[model samples]
Target: MAQEPLLRCSGMDKSFAGVPALRDVHMSVAAGEVRALIGQNGAGKSTLIKVLTGVYRRDAGQVEFAGNPVDFTSTQDAQRNGLATIYQEVNLVPYRSVAENICIGRARRRFGLIDWKAVNAEARERLAALDVHVDVTRPLVEYPIATQQMTAIARALSFDAKLVIMDEPTSSLAEREVATLLDVIRRLRDEGVAIVFVSHRLDELYAVCDTITVLRDGRTVADSPISELSRYDLVSTMLGRELTESERRGQHVGATATAAAPTVLEARDLRRAPVLNGSSVTLRRGEVVGLAGLLGSGRSETARALFGADPVTDGEIHRDGEPVRFASPQEAIRARIGFNSEDRKGEGIIPDLSVRENITLALLPRLLRRGIVDRGRQQEIVDRFIRRLDIKLAGPDQKISELSGGNQQKVLLARWLCTDPEVLILDEPTRGIDVGAKQEIQNLVRELADDGLSVLLISSELEELITDCDRVVVLRDGATVAELEGEDISEKSMLHAMAEGTAATGSRQPSGSREEDEVHD
Candidate 1:
């Protein structure tokens, strides 16, 4: 009596090398369903998506699509069979025109020649459907990241796919762009397109997804209609524990006491041409200061400038009230400053290296004597931080790529901690990790600040800034607009400043807490 689902996977099992990435996983999506696939990093969400999309072969599983069992050998084969995927990273060629990137494989042909006019027109129309307008002839690298993301979405939908799998689609999108994408998703579902939406943004999941499937440690832990699951329960299920009242509020433990702490690093009037206009931030010893902003508001740019990864065109950086210029990351490191980048897969981890090597990467210079690494000292530091961070890996000798996303992140953290830096800059440190890993990183940051390490934290999550920051600096259009501390730092205040580019200096009580009002009155 019930309609058969459009896409279904049962008893799916996959392994890499000797480690199992998925086990006994089951999922189903109706013809017009928007299903959410969520889990902590390395919980097998990516693995299952890869298995379904033909990126990786499943050892054991039955994948049924449109009333037939299918095993695709490659992504192209899967795409041709009416299943399309937009990966977490945009897979389009950056150097090619936007039209070429969108219509590369399936370009319209006429008289044995590719139809350039038809291809460009189709790409333009597809992007326009998503409310994105751009020159299709221009190279994709010429567009902003948000535009590129929309282009990817347009390409996936252009396939007339029965089931479209989107992984972290809004990770680089601005709030307005995210709303547009969600609307497009709703339209797709209404038109009978099944969508498997993968994102860490809970609000987006609730907004667009019809069903929810949760994975944990390579197993299907929970599956239900989206309405039947509450946010708390969703997180609890993914984390494998019920969150406490404090944890629910994202309150990090060991809030630093740094009222009298001296400033360790300061950037004044930092200017970088395209992305960063003018931004500034100050980090004090024993303090965790958050740089809050929307995408493209210069949050990462500011962090990178401070780390000397991207040299600022005009700015002054100071250490201990003395002016300093770091032309490179090596110079910054030598000055006891460490940086963890947001692009974990691309910039943060060296996948080919072993966990031990990646962990000791930054500190290797100090561990070397006469151009030879002091293996004993390197191992001592690596072992200490691995245990301290609770990194989950087979052994230190294992390739870093073999570890889960969270463990890889911990190794990156260990890499910087081993440097014994006085100041650390973390950009979106918990971006794609699960709630449990997020909390652990937050706790570690708080503890580090408590132990007198100054941290400049950049995160798009307002709750993260409110929970862990001693001071919150809001950026708008690549410039600092507000700074809140003490009882003034709240979600409402930060959102106000981030949107309006004005200081939210406690004009009114934050809706997040009545305790502040009670205490104030």
Candidate 2:
């Protein structure tokens, strides 16, 4: 007799504000199997997860658990039914001890008094079963993000959950931490637990997932065993493209720099406690330097330090052979340094502002005369970038939130470009955007570099970074591990750096090795 699926969904449909977020989506998970749910941003992956977890109700669909039809009215209802979800950002009380975090609402008690000793002991046992060692008595925030993630997993497993849904679990983990997580996941699968893993890291997906379910524009495009799909094919399916070898190779015509360009910006021993540790790199005129690493590898931290978005506790930044200090983003801007943050919605864009207002935001002072707005000058700059970047919107007057993700990103780029910056620090520039838009942005980046603008590009897409960057700097645990230039930049090399935490031959020497690296907790 064939065993039934642990969880299954059919004809699932969901919408928000009349916008179809998901349609006719189907997914199934079997006991002891690891399934990966993957898609580009806004492809309805999150929506499907929310629907499955009862965070959002489905307009139409059938959910079955162990051959029994079920409808969960709330997340608690789903939890009660043996389904558990761990978000990308672990949600737990920071002040609470790890034991309390793991068994908060369901703590064991005697005479209605919570048993703290018993709770910690049980929590310790659960973590031990997962091959994780941690001090359960300490506050959850006392551990590194990776350890906290493991604690969350321990909590879910302790609940006797038959199925676990992890969304971007490794997004904030280091290389060693990611390995620990992969091991924990495998152990869970061996114990007959079903897992749904969601992540943007293709390497991580291929490493741990047994099967893959691809969603595109809110629809299930394909579902199959991992061995049945190639990386190129999977990407094409997710992107809805008939990409050629050249396209897959990312060979777009754009700016290519030579080795002799003068270095415009340099960082020596850049440090931010608990995130970046003595990370340093340099950007030259007409060059695109890429920061490559897994999540929590300090890629964003380095960018922040360089752009003065975060305070640099240690290290020195020199521009044009002169020491420069940027106390804030405003000071950085005054020095012709521009930064496009990774969190576009939260940090990059102002939703209520018009396109024109956002684009000319950084250049307002230059466009102002005697404290009055120079409307004509602002319009001219906005119009130029809008056309040049091919930003699609009603007009410069359109609200930024009304535009698509790609267009919103373009507006952000325009925002920085209007500053006429000598150095541009772009973090995850193409994230949450469409394929065509991503390519366009890449081409624009190349074009700008060709026009003598120095750029520091940070992206999680290894292939994109390898192809577009003139040189690639790989970071591990907040420090530069390798610098690949010319022929050294390849997907294989980058993967090796991320996996083995080793510097490549001829690559720039990292400050230290994995063993010498300090653990945050």
Candidate 2 residue lDDT tens string, 90-158: 988899999999999999898899988899999999989878788999999888898899889988877
Q: In model 1, what are the clashing residue pairs, if there are any? A: none
lDDT of 1 by residue, 181-201 (tens): 899899888989899999866
**Separate clash counts for every candidate:** 0, 0
* Strongest candidate by lDDT: 2
- For candidate 1, what is the lDDT? 0.82
How close to the true structure is residue 475 of candidate 2, measured as C-alpha lDDT? 82
Provide the TM-score for each candidate, comma-separated: 0.63, 0.71
> Which 10 consecutive positions of candidate 2 have the poorest summed lDDT?
246-255
RMSD (Å) of each candidate, 1 decimal: 8.3, 6.3
**Model 1 alpha-carbon drift over 4 Å, by segment:** 133-135, 244-335, 339-421, 424-521
RMSD of 2: 6.3
